[model samples]
Target: MLLAGCAGAPPAPAERPAAEPAPPPVAAVPGVGVEERDWLPPLFSGVEDEAHYYISRLPDRRFVTTYGGEEHPRPWYIAAERLGQIGEPAIPLLAARLESSDEYELMLALYALMLASQDPSLMAATGGDTLELGSVLDPRHNAENLALARAWWQRQGWRWE
Candidate 1:
C-alpha cells in the first residue's frame, strides 16, 4: 500500500533545463560603422574629465613613432596609455570606437584595447611584433590590423570582463 501511494505520488518535478549562458554585452554606441565626422570628440569639454578627454583626443595623429619603445608626441599614443590606465571601464568605449571608419580612431581604439585588457592574444592578433605608427598608417597593414581587431572583438570583446 505504501508502495502504491508512492507510485501515485506525482513523479518528481522534471529537472529544470540548465539556464542558457547570457549573451555577450554589446557596445554602448549603436552603429557598427563610422560616421562622416569624428563623433568622440564632443563628448567631453576638456582634460578635466579623464576618460572622455583621452577618448576625444585619441584620433589626433599629429605625432607618431615607428616603434613602441621610442617616445612619441602623438596624442593618440598618450590617449591610449591614459585609457589603458583607466582599465576595464574603458573597454566598451574603446570597443565602440573600433567600428569607426577613420583609420586613426580604429587603430587607437585597438591599441587602447590591447592596453586595457592586457591580453597577449589581442597583442598577438593585432601584429604586436610589427605594430608601429607607420604600420598603422599603411593601408595594407591597417586593413590587416583592422581585420584582426574585428575578429578579436567578435570572439572575445563581450567576455572581456
Candidate 2:
C-alpha cells in the first residue's frame, strides 16, 4: 500500500541524514610487545583496560574453583595461566589476591609471584605472615611440588617459609 506524501504543499525537502563521524583509529601495538587486544592491560596495553581482567573474569561460579580442596583443577588455574602473561605488572594483583581465603587462588598467586620474582616488590609480598596455599615447600609432605617450589625459589634466589 503506497501512502501518499502530502497532497498539499511541496513535499518536505528530502532530509539529509547526518553523517556519523568515524572513530579515531588506534595505533598498532609493537611487535616485540604483547598485542593490546591479546592480553589484559600492561601485559598488553590498551587491551583489557584493567589489570587482572583475565583472571578476574574467569568462571568463579564453578563448584570446583581454583581455591583448592576436592576440585582437581580450580578456577584459579586460569589465573595462573594469565599470571605468566603479565610479567612484573602482575605482581601487585597476585599479591593482593594472595590475601584471599581461597587456598587455590592464593597458591596460584604465589606461584605467579614466583615466576615474577625478578621484581623487588615481590619480596615484600612473599614476606607475609602466613600464606594460604595448596602445599608448603616442605619436601616431607608433597615431595614433587615441594621440589618444584624449591627449584623455583633457587632460580629467583628467594627463601620462603
Candidate 3:
C-alpha cells in the first residue's frame, strides 16, 4: 500500500533536462582592443552646443583618420558617414575644416564635404578630378580646389543660411 501511494504521486513530475549555460557577458575594457564610447575630441569639448558638437567633430582627425588604419572602418569613419547623412547642415563646418586641413586630412574633409553637399560644381571642380603624384605630394592644386570651393560657397551664401 505504501509503494502504491508513492507511485500515484504523479511520478515526481519527471526530472527536467538541464538547460544550456548562458554565454559569458561581454565586457570591453577601455583602451584595450575596444574603442572608447566618449571618442569626441578635445577641440569639440567646448563647442557652443550639441549641434555644434556634431559640426565640430566633422573635421577632427581622430574621428576620421586616413585609410591605412584597419581592415574595418574606424570609429571616425563611421561618424563621418553619419555626418555625411546630415547633408547641407554639414557643409559650413566641412568647408571650414577643408580650409584648415592638410593633404590627407584634406582628402578626408573634401570627401566628406562632397558627400554632404552633393553639389555638382564642387564635385566637378574638386572630387571629380584626381590629383597626380606630384599634385598629391604638393598642396598647390589642393589650395586651388580650396579657393574654388570657398568661392562657390561665397556665391551661394544665401543658401547656407
Candidate 4:
C-alpha cells in the first residue's frame, strides 16, 4: 500500500527535462545612456545614459590604445564603432587606424564616420544642416554623402590649409 501510494503521487511531476540552459542572466548593472543590458562584458562598468556616456563619450589619446585592446572583433565592432560615435574626437585615432588597418577596421572607421556625421548628409548638403557621421554610418546610402564630404569640403567655408 505504501509503495502504491508513492507511485501514484503524480509520478513526481516528471522532472521537466533540464531546460535549454536558461539564457545568460541580463546584467543587473544600471544603464546610463541606453539600455545595453546584454553583450557588455561582465567586468565592464558602464552608465546607462545613452548620451552622457556609452561609447559616445569623447575620446582622448587613451582611446587609440583602448580601442585596439579588444581584438576578437567579429562581434561588437560597435566598440570600434565607438570610434565613430565619439566623432572628431575619434577622427585622429580613426585616421591612424585607417592608415594601417585591416579591411574590417577601415570599415569600422567608415561606419564611425557615418555615425558621427551626416545623419543625412544629403539634407546637410542641401543646406538644412550637416550630417553627423557618428549618427549615420550604418545606413546603406552613406557612400554618396561621404563623396560629398570629400568633394565639397572647400566650398563649406574652410581651407585645408
- TM-scores of the candidates are 0.47, 0.36, 0.45, 0.33
Candidate 2 TM-score over all chains jointly? 0.36
lDDT of 2 at 9: 88
User: In model 4, which range of ten residues has the least summed lDDT?
Assistant: 59-68
lDDT of each: 0.59, 0.47, 0.52, 0.41
Predicted candidate 2 versus true structure: per-residue lDDT over 51-123, tens digit per residue? 3574574325341223444766434344455554555565455555544565445455566555555444554
Ranking by TM-score: 1, 3, 2, 4
Regions more than 4 Å wrong, model 3? 1-9, 12-51, 58-60, 64-79, 101-105, 119-141
Q: Write the per-residue lDDT of candidate 3 for residues 21-139, one digit (tens) a residue.
A: 99996555322223434454434332234325655564455664334366764343544454455555667676667656456556555555545666455446455432212232134
- What lDDT tens digits, residue by residue, belong to model 1 across residues 68-155? 3347532235667667766556767777787688877777777776666664554565454322233553434666776666666676
Measured by TM-score, the strongest candidate is 1
Model 4 alpha-carbon miss at residue 97, Å = 2.9
Best by lDDT: 1
The superposed Cα distance between candidate 4 and the true structure at residue 90, in angstroms, equals 1.1
